[model samples]
Target: MNIKKENDKEDNENVEVFDEILDKSFIESYDPSIIVENQVTTETNYGDFQHLGCYIICVLIIYEFLLLLLMGNITFLIFGAAVPNVIGCIGENKNYTFTENGCIKLYEIQKNESCIPIIENQFESIQSEYNLYCKEAENVKQTSAFLQMFAMMIGATFGGQLSDNFGRVKTIKYSLFFIIICCFLSSYATTIEVFNIYRFLGSIFVGTKSSVLHVLLLEYLPKQHRVWVSTIFSFSPNYIIFSFMAYYTKNWRDLMFVISFIGLIGLILINFVKEPVRWLIQKGKLSKARQSMIFIEKWSGKLTDNMEKKIFDYIEEESFKQEESQRRKKSYTFKHLFVTWKLTSYSLFFGYSALVGCFINYALIFNLEKVSGSIFMNTAYLGLIRWFFNISVGILDYYVKWFGRKTCHTLAMVTIILTLSIVLLNIYFPLQQQYIVRFATLFAISMCSQIFIANSVAQTELFPTSIRNIAVSFQAVFARLGSIVAPFLFGFQSYSLTLPYLIMVTMSIVDLTTIWILIPETKGDKLKDHLPNKDEWIFGKKNRELKLLKKVELEKKYGSRCN
Candidate 1:
């Protein structure tokens, strides 16, 4: 028994020596930045649960739904269905002798002393008020939409710079305030010119608020949960809400007033949300970051004292690094996006994808007016389809590990390409079944919407914290360009029904090629918080490989505990 006990003791001592040597080896090659990043990753994983995550998500949903009311389903529903000539008649030769189908002869016309031409409408609209049925005024509708998109493009770029330089929270609040003001003014405008001007201005604020909100939400959430939260939040319920509101509200002015009121509600709700700790740390606001961490700890019941200590240790270390670099700290702008070849490649591919996606999606929407159906029903169908696909994609992203970001993206592109091809077939074969045509178009749009959210989460994952907001906003600029061009593309249908779809297919092919060639798979990867170093910037491989290896070593040493 004594001999056996001695042998067991010797075995235990040898095991300890091995562990000590392994730890020493790890310590010698330790990178403080990597350790800090891992600590943050762990903390965020824990932070994904409890009251804090729920609260933030609720606030974001409200913000998105409210903004969508102003610019999404509601705006499209009102404008797309507002034509006076759809159900009524514009009289011929300054006489009210025209029937719903055609102009009647003088013998069939009702007797009248003064035969002045009158325009009749099913509902009050800009088309009725401004006499937009004439060829001279037809372009005005397209011009209004184009101006709004152009303004949004400008706003997105401006918001990115403002958010990075100032702060996300500040930018959101200010943008909301301005949006409310613009909506209110739009509701009371006496002239079409004034109404359009207010709408253009309001769209700018909407774009700003949207871009900053995305960055803020992503920064607050964990990597795994971000896909779902970002995707699901984008699933706007406003389409259903707008359908009911438009059914009851006949006047466009009343609709505008209601949208403005919703904007006010959003402004009030934004105060309950907090700034992201990651953003605060990146900006070197350690005190604020510490306070935010304490707030998180208070709400998160699962967090332990040890976890809290490790988190603060990371903050302390980061503070030292920030102080060391404070004197040489430079502010990032849109121009920095082109400074490196890697960045330039990412920017070009992503921007083109955004542009193409917006063009195809909105072009389909604008073409809805030509589809033979109730406009309200078409809008409702699209809204429901988008909601269904958004949830489905979100669930897939959250649950399916193998069906990753790039896979989801590629699948969406394929779906779009195939559906657009079907649209082309319908154009050539001339489908007699209108419902079949509607379904194909809606399906294509649903897939486009899926791509919209997927690209958002994927791009956010790609860019670092320093320029993340601006990079996203730059994509928004391209998306707005697509939106701006959609009206003009739809105009080509007047010349050739197949022209627009052909262009869209060509663009989708280009986008798919860019995706495989330029974009990297970013799933199961750590979120980079800083720009690449000199070596990594030039070669684009060294730092990432080194950091990844260190992560593996740490994970192995910790075993399941790290997971």
Candidate 2:
């Protein structure tokens, strides 16, 4: 209807229609077509919600991750806290007294023994407290470590399933609760068996929470924020800080007591949080999903009394995706990951990259001892560089998107391989001591480790929300295997000083090959934008103009005019 008349003298622009559509009375009439038709064009669409609720929830998740990473690192720190306690074991070897039962080793006795001076610091360690030394020392350490790893594997698999089966928000909250309880108990463990048991149980929740953290971050963040958050969350910069504290405090139990309270931060946030809207919808909890959608509107500063109808319209006409009857019914399990081609490839490449990354990193650490400067300062140098890299990655990720993920990772791996080759050369042909500066060579090698942080962002982008945690968790299992193998590579140092370096170069080449072939360029992709053959309308704001335009034509044909 060209209702404008010559006498009316209209401006060609239709300003009145927008004002009328946006008006309170027009909105209250509840004819969905009025908004639906104009929603395609002529402006003043549904409340202009930004869905900022995701960010609000993501902040809490990030805090949770930071605390968990710090605590995980602390587990290693605490284990080594009482190395000085071995002085007693060294001294006890001198006492060779024969008794009827057995040779009783006595403490504080002046047995004629040559010994290195022991530091008199009052560091109370689990080793000192449990007397895990001499005959059983290696057994104690290896057994306790095995228990934790075994439990962690169980926890990782269980946690993935739990997160997928339950919900991200719920799994995080409940898992953290268990962490607090187990951590507190572990701190007070009075015996070796008790301590190992405590550690094993705590690892379950720790491993579970670890798997859930990245999934939660990606699920709640927008595409842009995910890029930044994924980059930031991928590395733990707090290791140095925890190391300093553990060094000065001289008591691990006290440090652990402090870590237990870390989960309290997440506990507070989880109470008022909403699960990811995509997750809710996928699980068919339509009511809760709609509630979360409204929360998103409110959190994004787009509240409207008319939100009820809008949410319903979104669920019925937009967010709700009904699968075809001919399609196979599938459950959310690890098996789906194998069947999905893109997902399978992503998992394989992600696992391989992580494996090689861990392998190269640990191999560097194991063989780093032969470098010139003080080993402590050299290590501190490495850690500080890594910390700086982690912080800078958030900024670096902006540039990474331009090159594409595959290119970025390939370049990084190649660069590190070159760095390794140079370091190996320096090992055989020692750089002149007077000519070399402090930490110069060490700095070159250490800085290349940033590839792990840079690639971590791409790693997160590779998985879908439905099984993201599963993919990441299982991939980490491979990475853990690499870490285990890395220590053994130190034996290469016995064969040749540069043997580990050669092996690391090989691993880097393998990483580059895997990345080049398997990983798709995930640059500028929204989370899970690579899903294969998605025929259903997913809940996102993009493409709404075309969708609304197509629907409005059907409305007009059906004679459902809002006017």
Candidate 3:
């Protein structure tokens, strides 16, 4: 007995020695005090663990950098959709209405004088260069918006699939490379058609970079930080950049060049980004996973030996589960999304909510130029409200479990409805109150946008790993859909500014009703493990049949060898 006991002890010692040499990893994913007394425990040095927090912060910084860049691309619509208002110059003839169609500024080149189309400051846009005005103006702008959204949808659909098939880092690298190329080429386009094409193609690149980039950081972050990341990732707006840069970059070409350059910088910086160890394990790339774990552990600082074993063992078991899943059955496909009950319900409603959210967000942004002050200052205020609210929600989520996600989601919608109603009602009050109402509308927009972000954690949680990429990416699809239609809805301004607000208020009410019925609280659920039998239902697995079939296969394979 002593000999056997010594052998077991020696085996354990050998494993620990191997870990020390190999630098195997574990997480301080939980508080150290929660560990069982029988298990190995480590001293908590807040000073030492600060490095771990800083490392994660570094990851978040890189993540937000990429997100901000892609957001810069996604928000190109804010400018493109504004081209109609900004592109018009004084017509030479003043008789453009007689010959041409509606609302066109005619530039006639008399004798020796040059035909200067619409020149705003020192720069001109593609709309001016192509003379895409009059009846064609709205169509051109709407087409650009639609094409951008359509391309984004395609990129997101595939980006998610590729993130699942390859890895997050790989998807981002390829997508951003394509974006840089398209944007650089678009900058040099002499014609409107070519510029529009490039913009459409470039949006695909940004779409591919969107969901997966955020997911990479998400897998590495803890629960609290995940909310922080989610809020930032979801509420991304490039209005601040536009607000400031517009003062310098009056030329469309220069703007494209600058945006492309940022994308190139992201491509270079991405080299330092490590793929999540969870993804590596799922791919069955254990060697790469081990290396990533080493990076994580080195950053996380000293861990208990037992905790190290526990973390690694958990990873290894999950990897084995992935392999077993593949061997036992065919992988789940997109078709499985609609067939499942709860998933179908959640996806449909969330997608619609996302659609409404995007429309409302863009509708507000498209009208920034019309706001009665310095456009840059107005834009900056919108961005600041979003930031302040982002921090507010993150702090609230971390400190208080006051309301479940469902309740919070409903509350946010109701708040927007109430605030918007006040703004509308303020129209009847004195002129003094009208200014406050305008500010109130901005506040309402910020609150609505924040809810969309704070709820993103539910997206990553509700679906199984099998569908998470597409599930999250799918929300982007609907978001882009809303973006596509927003400018057209803003076209209602040709009738009355209040017309758009009236339509939005009606839509918000519908969205609130749908969300309440279809959505459930995901506030307390554990990430990735909240849903039961996800693997089974996701792959259309029924318990008894799968068990019986597995039993038959196992007996056939092993029975003859045993005999």
The candidate maximizing TM-score is 1
TM-score against truth, every candidate: 0.80, 0.69, 0.76
The local lDDT score (0 to 100) that residue 400 gets in candidate 3 is: 78
lDDT of 1: 0.71
| Model 3 misplaced stretches (Cα beyond 4 Å) | 1-52, 84-125, 128-139, 232-238, 303-307, 319-323, 422-434, 493-499, 529-563
- Which sections of candidate 2 miss by over 4 Å? 1-75, 78-147, 304-311, 318-320, 323-328, 362-384, 399-401, 432-456, 491-497, 529-563
Instruction: Give one digit per residue, the lDDT tens place, for model 3 in 411-477.
Output: 7777778877776665545456455766766777777666676456777667765577777788878
Cα lDDT tens digits, model 2, 204-287, are 777777666666666666555555555444434444555555556557687677667665665776677678776775566767
Better of 1 and 2 by lDDT: 1
lDDT of 1 by residue, 1-563 (tens): 99999999976765565466456584465554543333533433223322335455565666574556445422543443355543332344443445453213322332533333355554566666666653333466677778777888888878888988788888988988898898889878888888889888888887787678777877777777777766666634566667666656666777777777777787887777677777788888888887777777665544678867866787777888789779759998887777568888998888998998888887777656455566667767877887887777778877888877778778888888898898799877987885887788878877777777778777887888889998999998998889888868966867897888899889988888888888888876667777765323434444444444555566677797867
lDDT of each: 0.71, 0.58, 0.65
Q: After superposition, how far is residue 530 of candidate 3 from its true place, in Å?
A: 9.3
